[model samples]
Target chain A: MKLHFSTTHEDHRIALLAALAISIYIIESAFPSPLPGIKPGLANVITLFTFLCYGWKIALQVSLLRVIISSLLLGTFLSPTFLLSLSGSLLSLGILMLVHSLFYPHYLRQYQPSAIGYAILASVSHISGQFIVAWYFFIPHPELFKLLPILMTFAVILGIVSGIITQHLINKLCSTHNK
Target chain B: MFTIGNILFKTTDFLILLSVSSLIIWLYSIFWSTDTLYGQAETLQVQYYNQVAIDYPLDTDRIIKVEGSLGSSIIEIKQGKARFIHSSCRNQFCVFHGWLNIVGDSTACLPNRVSIRLKGTLNPYDAIAGSQ
Candidate 1:
């Protein structure tokens, strides 16, 4: 017996976005790191953009695909790098979905998380999730806590930067799509 | 709409940004405080010529003298920070290495065969705990 799979429009969109993000991830990894284990994570802009435009379901799919595919391409699959990436993606996605469910409903629409809000939350959580997993499962050094302030500083700054980029993209593209 | 320069976002987005910024400040206060790390990450371990390293307390400012293969090396601990003040080594690389305050920080005077390492619970015990 043979099994067949059907693809939907949503699947195609997720794949396309994920491919874009994977390309960004691979390119970013090739650059020299000023500090070990720190990257700007520019690829996250794609995930944030998808979440803002399409909603959490598609965003989650895009994010997971990006992590899996990027790790496979970079030869980090099942390694510590892959685990850290997976944990960060899962955590950021979990929070994104949680926030979306709470606000994207009936009367809560007025205070809906804008692209900037979602981007900041996702990026900040992304770094922090990687930090905690590194501390617990891999390093476990208490001095690692010292780097947290610096790391979070980078995270917050990068979050704001990415948040602005995501907001700008939403302004340009989302408006065009809603019509 | 909340406008930052040219980019525009909702009031809620600005609020989220405000709260997250404050969170970074809070983390800075907790983990990056110089006052806390000064006394906590103590002791500088100095060694030479395959001899077991001796732990020198970083709390009291003092000059430590260690005998290396070539000549004596001087290490100074001031204000909970250690550095090689003078070394018999020709290159003077160890003295130029500057301050070593953080745990696991190390520098060596290769010609004199002398080395100094910052020792603390922050690294060794944690490594054992993690690998086990």
Candidate 2:
């Protein structure tokens, strides 16, 4: 099957992808909240769609470039906070990509459930990465593990919400007529 | 190969339940304990070393004192708030942390072996329990 991008032209498609990623990052970051880290991670939806539509290489590129640009644009460049955010994004993307490749085709009919499952897992991975880095550098303590369960509860709730949203958008965008 | 994602998803529901329960447990533990268990005031030690040396039995509400010899610094606190306001350490990160109020709030100058910390808890266990 010829991907839609072949007809859309290379430059236009690239621009579209970049715009989508930047928009996702900006929208997620702008919200002021008491919640420690509750980004919808809308950019992952773009990453997943691109992975399914184009290829893993492009998806990886999109995730990496988006994170780097977002960090620089957000004025967190080269800081530990930027590194923590990058690590979470990369870990989440890696988990999503792996899940998509192996179980996605087999569980196509259960896309919503699959999305939820993947979202929860990705959230855990992201949180774990951040916690590890934070514990090692910022707040060092073995007792810090006590904080994990509280964090996990929030991650599950937010993961389900983000996953449902992502799936809804993906289905709408990936429909035969929409593309 | 089963990735961490697979293991996590398989247990996501269970883990969420467990986390909720544990959070309740932690909260209960915090509120119900009769003794006030403080986090070690090591961090507060650094801030103490930056100011002038002080003697014991403090009586002021807000006092800041820093004291240290050539290689030893000690910040003594006798009141409500204290901090590692400054330090001669190489990094000087402790000096930047400023004031802290929590019991055992401290910063240390490792080179000087000096530590500063906020001393007492305003709401001690007896007061918290309304026994006093």
Candidate 3:
């Protein structure tokens, strides 16, 4: 017996991924951040996974849905934090697509980028977008620029961690599906 | 296939990413790090609510008091280093900043509207932290 849903398979898959991403986002937000603007951004793993498994379009849909739905759930809709998150997500997605198209095939005739490569590129662009938005719209201070190094360091660490996790999960899912 | 935990981990990809990240960090440090303090600060300038209260040489060991919006702040210059000793502000951020010996180091008691800035040959970077 198979379960029946109103939505198509593609819609169901996106909805499931969005739910997972939103759950991760909410859970991450519950934890206390060591610094004001620092976060693990673990939810990005889902986006990375979707991008690798499906394609850029599904990944983009999942990411946007996750951010908007999660922000609404967290009661941060239309707030400064929401704006920052939206900008970061959009910028990161753009960078991820660019890197995917440009480097995915050239380096080794591979179809797509390695998980770590995509993670690092997306994370760096995400943090940069957020920082630029925060500096321009919120703080507007040179002191804010000083946080770049610290933020980038955090981005690198988180990128590696999430990339490894996404790779492992994809391998597991793929192997099980093949079986 | 180079596999780590059943996943095809590419050595070339990892190396490329590592090099790129390191290069970025290196460039950032070169451009932003304040390790090379621009010429020695010859004097200290105290400002209260945007008004210049006093300008004094760092060669002397002395304390200067300046009144601000909230109350008075005591700035002490000793051993070519200057610091805020006391302020009426609840959070003593300025006082806690320890000392300012570099050309562009500064401390501000925002609540009290008092700021201490070093005066000398201006440096490209005012301050650099994290890359020790």
Residue A12 in model 2: shift from native, Å?
Answer: 4.6
lDDT of every predicted structure (CA atoms):
0.83, 0.58, 0.82
Against the true structure, what is each candidate's TM-score?
0.67, 0.52, 0.66
Tens-digit lDDT string for candidate 3 (A1-179) = 99985878999889999999999999999999989888889899998888878888999999999989999999999899999999899898998887666655555445455787678877888999998899999999866666787788788888878888888877766442211
**Which is the leading candidate under DockQ?**
1
Question: Which digits, one per residue and each the tens of the lDDT, describe model 1 over residues A36-109?
Answer: 86788889999888877887788888998999989889999999999999999889888888887788677887
lDDT of 3 at A69: 97
Candidate 1 lands at a TM-score of: 0.67
**Candidate ranking (lDDT, best to worst):** 1, 3, 2
User: Lowest lDDT 10-mer window, candidate 1 chain B?
Assistant: B123-132
Q: For all candidates, state DockQ relative to the true structure.
A: 0.46, 0.04, 0.24
Model 2: residue B23 alpha-carbon error in angstroms? 13
Q: Compared with the true structure, what per-residue lDDT tens digits does model 1 show for residues B1-132?
A: 757676767888878889888988888788777544643567888888698888988899999988888899999999989999999978898898899987777888988999888877555322211210
Error of 1 at B116 (Å): 22
Model 2 in CAPRI terms: which quality?
Answer: incorrect
* Candidate that beats the other on lDDT, 1 or 2, i.e. the better one: 1
Candidate 3 local lDDT, B1-132, one digit each (tens): 277766566664576478768966875775466543366687898888867467889999999988888989999999989999999999898888899988878888999998888878666476655421
Inter-residue clash pairs, candidate 3: none
